[model samples]
Target: MKQVILDRIRAALADRPGPVAVPREYRRDLGGTDIVELFAERAADYRATVTRVSTVDIAGAVAGALRDRGARRIVVPAGFPDAWLAGADVEPLRDDPPLSYAALDAADGVVSGCAVAIALTGTIILDAGPAQGRRALTLLPDYHLCVVRTDQIVGSVPEALSRLDPTRPQTWISGPSATSDIELNRVEGVHGPRTLDILIL
Candidate 1:
């Protein structure tokens, strides 16, 4: 009976029209606007703390940010710049032998670099690239401090997607991990870090 019904439906739709061409002229360029400034503004609108600094002040800025957040044990992902951690007044944990989830959860926060950042949507794209670690490293930690260079900021999602490697794992983070209950009660740190700090240099 099922096959008979399927045959009838197929026969009925056999005279359907051909594929239609849809226009996909989406905006890709950010125009003459400042992407870096726009990214900072949009990211801050999501409640993620945004700090702007120069390359020379990265070390000081990083240390200051960590100290401000009272981070004692920071998880330093593989390939993270050592100079950035110079002035940090905290114990850095390197995931050389692989750290357990419990340790990651207990850490003050995780610090790393991002592959690309979307200015329009204020999203941070992580592909486990240099200074970035496994997906779990950012997920388990309560706080995440991501350092993004100005050159890494892209105008739109398409632009950001073009810079990513599909084969490698990717984690897209916007602000902090949060969700609302049926009553509209907000909750943080449910799926990922409760707090997200962005350092733009």
Candidate 2:
């Protein structure tokens, strides 16, 4: 029944004017600016803890970030590397069996890799890729430790969008979830993790 109404709406709009072309007026001219530096600066402005680390020290960095947050039970999404969690003293909670919401909420944090990150907006995109698990894994936890490689950072939103698979479930996060709508008082963790730790490797 719901499908019938949607089909009727689509049929009504099918002939409603021609497809419109969107203007590309946004700035794309990043004249030799260091994107990584820009991304880190912008992400930090969003209150995310951004740490730049070499590939060799990624495991240590991840461990330290979790330790700093006192995250004892970290959600280990499927396909997340075991090597990355090697130095961390936390219990690795896998999503293979699909943990309950209570379990996810009780966990200290989550650590996963991103599909792409937009340097212009300081946004990270996840697509439930091998490193990224289901959307719930990242959302239910109080903290998130994201892994963003230098190569995955794009200069513009269009560039980032073009690189992603449209069929996949995508989550675009500019920072830890926040809002100032309720009584205009700024609040964090209302929608997502309160603390977002970014590991830029």
Candidate 3:
């Protein structure tokens, strides 16, 4: 009886129409708004703080962000720009072999550069690139300080995906780690950073 049913299912599928082509045209316009500004606004909607600064002052901005959070020790991926943290007074812990779970938990924060950011969704993607460490680097820390260049901001999700490598491990973060589970009470830092501060350069 199972063999007979399987044969009928196959015959039914064979009679279905071919798939249709999806339309490629969509809203790709930025509506005369600057991509970086749009991204900052969308990020704020998700409760993530954004600070826009000049390229020359990025180091100062990074330092100020960490200082405000009182983060004494910060972890960074190997090959991270030394100059970015030069102004910060915190101890820099490089992730050479990647930190163990306990060590990351104890660290005050993690700072890294993102692969790409979406202005429409207010999402940041990390592909383990340059300053972006391994997956665990961003996940285990309580505070995440991500530096996003103005060039890295895109208008939409499709634009962001087009710039990323599909095979590489990617982490997409919209806002601080949070959940409305358990009686719908909102909780932060459940699975990732409770505070996400974006330094827009």
Q: What's the count of clashing pairs in each model shown?
A: 0, 0, 0
Residue-level lDDT of model 1, residues 1-201, one tens digit each, is 999999998899899986689786999879998999999999998889999999899999999989988898999999999999998898998898999989998999999999999999899999988899888888888888999999999999989888888999998988887778748987766767888999998
Off by over 4 Å in 1: 1-14, 17-22
TM-score of every model versus the real structure: 0.89, 0.88, 0.90
Q: What is model 3's C-alpha RMSD?
A: 2.8
TM-score of candidate 1 versus the correct structure, residues matched by position: 0.89
Q: Order of all candidates by TM-score, from best down to worst? A: 3, 1, 2
Which structure among the candidates has the greatest lDDT?
2
Judged by lDDT relative to the true structure, which candidate is superior, 1 or 3? 1
Higher-ranked by TM-score: 1 or 3:
3
Question: What is the Cα-based lDDT of residue 126 in candidate 2?
Answer: 96
CA RMSD per model (angstroms): 3.1, 3.0, 2.8
Candidate 2 lDDT by residue in tens digits, 37-94: 9999999989899999997898899999999999999998888888888888999899
